[model samples]
Target: MKNEEKTKKRKAKRKLSTGLYKLAFFYAVLLLIIGFTLGVVYDSFISKGMEDEINKIIELSTTSEILYASGEEFCTIFPRTMKEIEEQTWKLGVMIDELESKNRIGEDLKLKYFDLQVRDFFLVKKASKECRINPLIIMYFYTNNLVECEECYEQGFELAIARNSLLEKVPIKIYAFEGKTSHSVVNYFKEKYNISSYPSLVFIYLEDGEERWLKEEGLINSNQILEKALTFQNASS
Candidate 1:
């Protein structure tokens, strides 16, 4: 009777483990499918000339300022791509927050997300340069693990509120990035900026005819954000 009971317990444990693995896998697949579906639907609506705008961005990646000769040129096509960049990056930020909240994100989706973010980061730079505006940049970096970086979502929420408040007064823009992606661009900035911790914010602004940045670790309130943002806002003015 003892030997029979032992065999039954072993089989039961195996079945339970298998069920948990399947549940995790189902969540991963469902998230990816939802992501892909949303991408397809969004592209269909904004399909016209989107490819050309992206190519322009890609060219800017190589030549940087050369492609952006005049504000007029970028002004014409840049609005559409600008809209695309903002939507893509912002939506992914929301998706990341949602995934972390539910604890259901997979490794594959995160890699894809990081790629879009890096690309859109370049687009933001391109837009600022061509538009001849020294926008106050708020770069929020965090990871997928909620347990590791629980404050990340709160940071995002506070920054969103700060942006809403400061947009008219300071020209502030907030962008969220996944800090632990394997993407080379993400890795490069991580090393260059000494980003050793999660829930990091990098504030980039124009000062003394050059670009400068201030890095902060952990969560910060909207009031603090408004303080630093207004400082840059004054400097640029």
Candidate 2:
């Protein structure tokens, strides 16, 4: 009778152990499937976002060219086109920033984004020349994840407000770039402009039929910057 009782207990314990193993295996498989599905969805979302940005750029380029050829002023196209481009640019920046925060961005996407930015910069240059309007290019450079300058944010905010105020007088565009950008174009800009610090502002204008860049650092006074911009415009004109 004792031997039978011991045999029964051993069989029951083995059954329970087998059931637990099966449950664990089932959960592991479920979790893997969920992870894979989420990964696919997220990848698709990222690709779609990039595609939208490219499309906006293409549309902006085409529309601006058409408007210019039709004898439209730079400010005239603002409500219909330029404003949208500006908004999209801001949105793109925010999206990339969020991705950077999550550390989910890949090198390939960053390279592509940088390439797009270079193209956009050239587009702005073309617009400035062809449109023949008061064009202001503020090149804002700073570290994304690190603070290279303590006053960079304040300086940037000041410039942004200044840009808004002069939007009517001058067709101003702000191109915010990461100082530690790996893009070769940024590297070229850094070398050409002698950018050595964070929160560097490069004010570019056409001087003597040649594109010129002016760098500003330290505590930025928006009013002073605006005056210089006006002077630059007058000189160019």
Candidate 3:
């Protein structure tokens, strides 16, 4: 009877050990599966993030390429004389007015014309002093929550004329901003001067590091725009 009892106890002990081993094995497999699943999820998330960043980079590169290409084209076909620029400006205005009347200027077309005006009318002018006041009269086309086009042809028509009227004026540099890539520069100016408009003009003097902002209300008239530019110029000087 004693031997039988011992045999029974030994069998029970062996069974308990085997059961514990099986349980541990099952849990190990479960833990491995869970880890693998988590790894897959994390990898997918990382890959998607990387892809989004790459797409943004590509879009910015394309925008810059378009601007550069457009500038080159403008330089190639630009008129050699101020008289020719004036003639082209008049023609462009007529076309733009007609387009606006007919609602034919799509967003893309507006952006293109805006860039064209900047390159042809503003940058192409050789006379630095004559171009001084032109910087104050920028035409901005807002798109994608940013300024897509900036030309002195439409919105700054009078300002351009005023700047051209003055002789021996100080040279002013105009910086064009487009797309989200230009947001940094725009925000910098806006923050610096507390600007609150899309096409706001800020006259900057590098000599004294002074900046004057022209608000949206003042930009309604060409004369007012020119006055603001002149004021900024005088203050900076």
Best candidate (score: TM-score): 2
Better of 1 and 3 by TM-score: 1
TM-score of each: 0.63, 0.65, 0.33
Measured by lDDT, the strongest candidate is 2
Itemize residue pairs with steric clashes in candidate 2. none
Give the Å error, residue 167, model 2. Answer: 2.2
Which 10-residue window in model 3 sums to the lowest lDDT? 137-146
The CA lDDT of each predicted structure is 0.68, 0.72, 0.45
Clashes of each: 0, 0, 1
lDDT of 3 at 138: 37
lDDT of 2 by residue, 59-137 (tens): 7766766766676675466444655666577567656656764666666666666666676677667766665653677
- Compared with the true structure, the alpha-carbon lDDT of candidate 3 equals 0.45
lDDT of 3 at 20: 83
Mark the 10 consecutive residues where model 2 has the least summed lDDT.
74-83
- For candidate 1, lDDT tens digit of each residue in 125-163? 667655655678878888767799888778878988887
Which regions of candidate 2 are displaced past 4 Å? 1-47, 62-83, 98-104, 219-221
